[model samples]
Target: MGDDSIGGRLSEFIGNLGGFLRKFIFSVLSVGPIPNHIAFILDGNRRYAKKHNLKEGDGHRAGFVALLSMLKYCYELGVKYVTIYAFSIDNFNRRPDEVQYIMGLMHEKIEGMLKEESFVRSYGVRVHFLGDLKLLHQSVRIAAEKAMRVTANNTKFVLLICVAYTSTNETVHSVHQCFKEKRRPMDKFQEEEQQQQQQGLIKLVDLERNMYMALAPDPDILVRTSGETRLSNFLLWQTAFCYLYSPAKLWPEISLWNLVWSVLNFQRAYPYLLKTKMKRY
Candidate 1:
C-alpha cells in the first residue's frame, strides 16, 4: 500500500477508537442522573490570546472551536439544553476594535451554522438568542434572528446563546415587559397597586414569563472556565439553585475530561440538589 493510504487508515482507526471510548464512557455515566440543561461562561479568550502571543481575534477563534467540541460532548451525553454566554453587555466596554472583531466573528459563525451541513442541522438543535438581542450589532442581530427562524422546528436539542446580555439587564427588561403586559385601566391599576403596595401587583410568574431566559429551564450545571467563581452578571436569577463548576483551564483549554468531571461532581450532588429544589417548591 502507498504511504499516504496507510497513514489515512491509521488516522481513521484512531478516530473510530476514540468514538467507541466516548460512547462507552457516556453509557456508564448514564447510570447516574444527567443534567437536563448545561450552561457555560466563555471566559479567558482574551487571556488565552495574550498567553499565546496571538492576536485577540485569533484567541476567540480558538475559543469557538472549543465551544463546538463542548457542544458535541454535551449533546452526546443527552443534555437537552445548552446555554452559552457568548457575549455580555459588559463586553462592549472593551476596546472598540475588539468589540467589532467579536461581533464580526459572531456574524460569521451564525451564517456558517445556517448551512445545510452545519452542526445545528446535524444535531437537530434549536437555536435561541436569549437576552437583549436588540443590543447586538445590526448584522449580528439579523443573523441571530435568521438562525432562530431556520432552526425553529428542530426538536432534539436546544442551544441558547446569550449575546449582548447581562442578568441584571434581562431582569430589568423583563420587569418592564411584565408591567407593559399587566397594564390595565387607570383605576384598576391604582387599585391593584395599592393592594400590592409600592412594588406593584406583578407576580413572580409574570416576571419569569417575561424573562429572556424563560425559553429554557434554569440550568442544572453552570461551568465557567478559567477558575472564575463569580457569575459576572451572567445568570444571577436562573442560577440560584444551579450547580456551579469552575475549571482552572482557560476556555480554549477545556477538554472532554473537564466535562466528564463536572458531570461526575454533579452526579454526586444530585440528591442534595433535588432535595433543595423540592423544599423550595
Candidate 2:
C-alpha cells in the first residue's frame, strides 16, 4: 500500500464523504419531536404549472415528484404514517379533460406500485385509498385495490391517498350509517335495553370507527402548501389536535427544507398540543 496510491485513498475518501452526508441528514432530523402521522394537503399543482408556463398537466407531474421526496424525508425523520389529500371530490367539478388527466395519472402511479422493484415495494409502504373509492374510474379503482392487497402485509409505513375524498362527505356518510345500522347513540347511564340491542350508539368512537380512515391514527401534523390557511375539507375529524403548517411553496416546489421545518415546528407545539388533546379526550 503506497502512500501515493491513487485508487485506494480516493475511493476511501469518497465513501467517508457519503457516510458523513448521511449522518448529517439524520442528525439534523434528530433535533425534532418526530410526529407519528403527517397529513398533507397537496395544493397548487395547477397554479405551479401556470406560474412556470408549463403544459397543462406538467405541474401535476412535478408535484408527484415532490410527493416521492416528501415520503423519503418523512421516513428518515421517523414519521410512521402519511395521509395526503391527493384528490378531492370537488376536483370532479373541474373540466372533464383535466379530471380525466388526473385519473389517468393516478392509474399510472398505482400500476407502478404493483412492480416488485418499485418505490412502493422498496420502501415497504402500505397504500390505502381513504375515500369513496367507488367513485373512481373502474381501471383506477382496480389498480388501487391491487396495490392495497399487495401491500396489506407491510407494517413499516402507511400511505393514505385521499382520492375523491372530502371530510364533510365523510361525516355525512358516517352519520347516515349510524342510523341505518340502528346504532344507539347513548351513554352508559341512559339505556340498558338499547345497549343489549346494539353495542353502542352514535358515540365519538362510533363515528371514528366507521370512518373511511378508521385504520389510521389521528394525524399529529397537517401540512398544507400554497400558504393555504384553511383545511379545504381535508381531515376535519382526524385533525382535532394536529399542528397545521402552511408553507408558501406550492406542491410542485415543496422541498426537503419545508418538511424539516414542518417537523421542527411540530416539535415546538407538541407540548401544548398534547395538553390540549388530553383535556379534549
Candidate 3:
C-alpha cells in the first residue's frame, strides 16, 4: 500500500478511537445517582444574540432549542425534575417592543411543544408554568396554560418553566394570601402573631404552600449559564440549600459535556456539604 493510504487509514482509526473514548467517558459519568431536581438559570440570551448579530427573537429561539436538548440529557442522567428560569418579572421593564417580541417567542415555543412529535411528548415530559400568570400577556398566559394542561398526565419527568417570575414577588404573594386567609382580625391576633413569629412558626414556609413551584421538589443543583454567579430572583425559597454551578458558557452554548463537568464538580464538593449538614439550621 502507498504511504499516503496507510496514513489516511491511521488517521481514521485515531478519530474513531477518540470518539469511542468520549462516549465511554460520558457513559461512565452518567452512572451513580443523579440529582433528582435540577434548575437552570438560562441567562445571556440577548447577549448571545447581540454577539452573533442576530435578531432579538433569534436568541430566544436558540435558547429554546438548547433547553430541549438539555432536557433530553437530564432524562438520560435520570433526573426526574428540571426547572428553568425562562422569563423574569423584571424582564417586563425592558423596552416595550422587546418585551412583546419575547412574549411572541414564548407563544411560539409553547405551540411548538404542543405538536405531537415534539420532545415533550416523546419523552413524556410534564410541563408546569411557575409564575404570576396575571402579569403576562393574555395570549402568552393562555399558551402556557394549554401546554401545562396537555402535559398534565405525563410522569416521565417534571419540567418547570418560570415565566414572569420573581422570587420576592412570589414570597410577598404568599404572605398576602396567608393574611387574607387569617381568621382573626390583625389587632386581636397581633400579640399571638408576634409570639408565633418569634418561635419561627410564622416564617416563610407557612406561606410557601401558596407560592408557585410549591409542589415541586427544591432543586438539588442550580446552574446558571454565561458565567453569571447571581441567582437573579429565581426560586428564592426553593433553592435554600441548592449547590450552585455557574459555567462560563452562554445558555445557547451549554451541552451535555458541560453538565457532566458540573456533576463531577458537585460530586467532589458533596463531602463538604455532608460535613456541614450538622451545622445547617
Candidate 4:
C-alpha cells in the first residue's frame, strides 16, 4: 500500500478512537445531574495572542476554535442552553482599529452560523444575540437579525451571544421598559394603587421579563477562563445563584480537560447549588 494510504488509515483510526472515548466520558457524566444551562466569559484572547507570539487577531481566531470545541462538549453532555459573553459595551473603548477588527470578526462568525452545515444547524441550536444590537454595525446587525430569524424554529438547544451588553445597562433598560409599559393610561384606582405600591412597584418578575436574558433560565455553571474571579459587569444580575469555575488557562488554551474538570467540580457542588437555588426561588 502507498504511504499516503497508510497514514490516512491511521488518522481515521485515531479519530474514531477519540470519538469513542468522548462518548464514554459523556455517558458517565450523564449519571450525575447535567446542567440545563451554562454560560461562559471568554477572556484573555489578547493575552493569549501575546503569550503565543501570534498576530493580534490570531488569538481571537484561536479562541473561536476553543469555543467550538467547548460547545460540542457541552451539547454532547446534554447541556441545552449555553450563553457566552461575546462582547461587552466596555470593549468599544479600545483602540478604534481593534474595535473594528473585533466587529468584523463578529460579523464573519455570525455569517458562518447561517451556513447550512454550521454548528448551529448540527446541534439544532436556536441562536440569540442579546443586548443592544443597535450598537452593532449595520451589516452585522442585519446578519444577526437574520440568524435569529432563521434559527427561530430550532428547539433542541439554545446559544445566547451577548454583544454590546452589560448587566447594569440591561437593568436600566429593563427598568425603563417596565415604567414605560406600566404608564399606559391606567384607571384612577389602578394609578392610585400603583402609587401606593411605589416602594415595591417594580416587581422582580417584571424586571426579569424585560431583561434581554429572559429567554433562557439562569445559568447553572459559569466558566470564566484565565482565572478571573470577577464578573466584570457581565451577567451580574443573572449570576446571583450561578456556580463559577475559573481555570488558570487562557481562553485559547482551554481544552477538553478543562471542561471535564469544571463539570466534575459542578457535580461535586450540585447538591449545595440545588439547595441554594431552591431557597432563592
Best by the lDDT measure: 1
Candidate 4 — which residues are off by over 4 angstroms?
186-200
For candidate 4, write residues 1-281 as lDDT tens digits. Answer: 99999999999999999889999998998889888999999999999999989998999999999999899988888999999999999998999999899899999999999888899988899999999999998988999999999999999889999999999999999999998888688887988887898833678889999999999999988999999998989989888887899998999899888878888888999999889889988
lDDT, candidate 3, 1-281, per-residue tens? 99999999999999789668666765786664467889999988888899899986788889888988888778877789999998899999999999999888888888999888999998998999987888889999999999999899999989999988999988888887776655445564786776676633455566877788786877778999999899898888877767899999889989878888887876776667556644765
Stretches > 4 Å off in candidate 3: 1-27, 184-204, 274-281
Give stretches of model 2 more than 4 Å off: 1-23, 183-193, 196-200
lDDT of 1 at 189: 67
Candidates 2 and 3 compared by TM-score, better number: 2
What's the distance in Å from true for residue 84, model 4?
Answer: 0.5
lDDT of 1 by residue, 1-281 (tens): 99999999999999999889999999999999999999999999989999999998999999999999999999999999999999989889999998999999999999999888889989999999987788889999999999999999999999999998999999999989988866655686677776676555688988989899999999999999999999999989898887999999999999999999999999999999999888977
TM-score of 3: 0.82
Tell me the TM-score of model 1. Answer: 0.94
lDDT of 2: 0.87
Q: What Cα-based lDDT does every candidate model obtain?
A: 0.93, 0.87, 0.84, 0.91
In model 1, which regions exceed 4 Å deviation?
184-200
| lDDT for residue 129 in candidate 3, whole number 0-100 | 92
Q: TM-score: which is higher, 1 or 2?
A: 1
